[model samples]
Target: MNKIVDLTLNYTNDFTGFSKETSRTIKKDGWNASILTFYSHCGTHMDAPIHFNVSQQTIDKIPVSDFVGKAWVIDVREVGSKGLITVNHIPNDVLNDFVSGDSLVFWTGWSQYVNIPKYRDELPRISKDLANWCVDNKVKMIGVEPPSVADVNNIEEVTKIHQILLKSVVIIEGLTNLEKLQSNCVELIALPLKIEGGDGSPARVIAIEKQ
Candidate 1:
């Protein structure tokens, strides 16, 4: 039998620019209702090219097929904080498993800091070399257990990395629970909310392990 693993972080009020406020109390309205206010890029989200450039593609323009595919989770937990996650981090055997259109997610074990201040601080970021490798290998999409693929402190590099991958591969960031998945290879489905002309959207990511 196969099992499904939810790879998303639950959206909460504490997250930056996120709020679920009561619009009507159950006792007063006889029903439960709330108003949600959040940045489109809040929580576990997928970024579009438009995020880096206003004229570039938006999340709504990306094909649904790009959000789901055969995936491999490359474990790079050993790469410490603010470390560059280079191609060397992946073993040769694991590196050879990549194929065109394959979705790849890195398991850096950073999800544990979700509720901590360090969560948004320095994080293991993908190196330019690895980003180039993904492009050369024709990868379809990439996901990470960090807020962004590039160092958030370096706006220039962040934009560069996003531009590189956005040219071909979709980028999924702020992913959590990647450790709960037992299989290296699984079907990845990370669908983001469709916001017209929006740069990105929070997403619900999941993995389906094959039997």
Candidate 2:
């Protein structure tokens, strides 16, 4: 048996990086629909190398198979707001078992602040050392509950961290519900919208835990 968990935030009128307006109604237009506008980097989104000028790759250019992989969720909830997480924070067992092409997810417990201002402004970020480790180890992707892997407020820090990781690994941010997963490792499938020449796009992410 296996359990599935949705790791994406519910997009709504109040959700960041998204705006929705009713365009049709069932009673009037005989159908229901809305006009959706999404921010490329907002709300459970995936980033392509072009996002940081690291490369010319776009969200649509990514192979669909690259979006799915085995992910090891590292519990990093102890890192507080605006905390810089280094490679040392990752347990030795995870480092020993984590192999090339496997993704790494950080369970920072920051999604609880999704509705407030703190979620983006005071997010925990990955340090440069950790970013180098991801690239050095050939991690396929890095997922975090925060909107960005680096400090969003710092121009230099954010740019440097993103460039390092974007050079080799895909990035998935604004993930939620990691606490519900019972296993440390799971199959993660994160599919992003195929927007032509787009640097990023909102993604629907999920984790399958084997029972």
Candidate 3:
């Protein structure tokens, strides 16, 4: 049997406490509820094309078939802080194994900094060349354990990377717990919330190891 690993982050309020709460008392019983305050990009999330382009497809309009598929996890842990993950970081043998429609998951070892400001502001990023490679190679989706594929502080680089990949590929961000998965190839499933017209939505990402 294959082992399943969850790669989603836990959602919480305001990075601290609940944003809103309500309670109702009926007879001798009571009910309580709370509204969550989270960024759509928070936790493990899917980036719809509309996230970068207004005229592009919204989250709900995204094809459900794109959410699950064979995936490759490339490890670039040796890359330094704020380093660029270029084509070279991907092993030649790994590139040879890529199929036109396979999803690519990058393990930059950045998930270790989640909840820290540095995780968003100072982290390794995918370079333009790598983005172009994915486009030219016909990658179905790109998943990363970091919050984004580009430097969070560099808007221009971020925009360019998003524009390039978002044009034809789904982007999965904020993945967690990928270090637990030992295989380089696995079945990936990133299911986003069915929010109509949403630019992007949080998702529950998982990997199924092959026996």
Is candidate 2 or 3 superior in TM-score? 2
Q: Report lDDT (CA) for all predictions.
A: 0.87, 0.93, 0.85
Q: Who is ahead in TM-score, 1 or 3?
A: 1
Instruction: Flag regions of model 3 displaced more than 4 Å.
Output: 14-32
lDDT tens digits, residues 1-211, model 2?
A: 7899999998987986689999999999999999998888888999999999999999899989889999999999999999988899888998899899999999999999997989989999999999999999999989999999998889999999999999999999999999999989999999999999999999999999988
TM-score of 2: 0.98
Residues 1-211 of candidate 1 have per-residue lDDT tens digits of: 9999999999998788799999998799889899999898778999988888734688898999899999988889888799898888777777777779998899999888886766768789988888988888888889999888988888888888887777788999999888788889999999999989979999999999987
Q: Enumerate residue pairs that collide in model 3.
A: none
Query: How do all models score by TM-score?
Result: 0.95, 0.98, 0.91
Q: Spell out the clash pairs found in candidate 1.
A: none
> Could you tell which candidate, 1 or 2, scores higher by TM-score?
2
Top model number, lDDT: 2
Q: For candidate 1, what is the TM-score? A: 0.95
The RMSD (Cα, Å) of candidate 1 is: 1.4
Superposed Cα deviation of residue 65, candidate 2 (Å): 1.9
**Candidate 3 residue-wise lDDT, 68-154, digit = tens:** 899988988888589888888777888888889998998888888877888888888888999999989988989988888898688
Give the range where candidate 2 is weakest over 10 consecutive residues by summed lDDT: 9-18
Q: Note each model's CA RMSD in angstroms.
A: 1.4, 0.8, 2.3
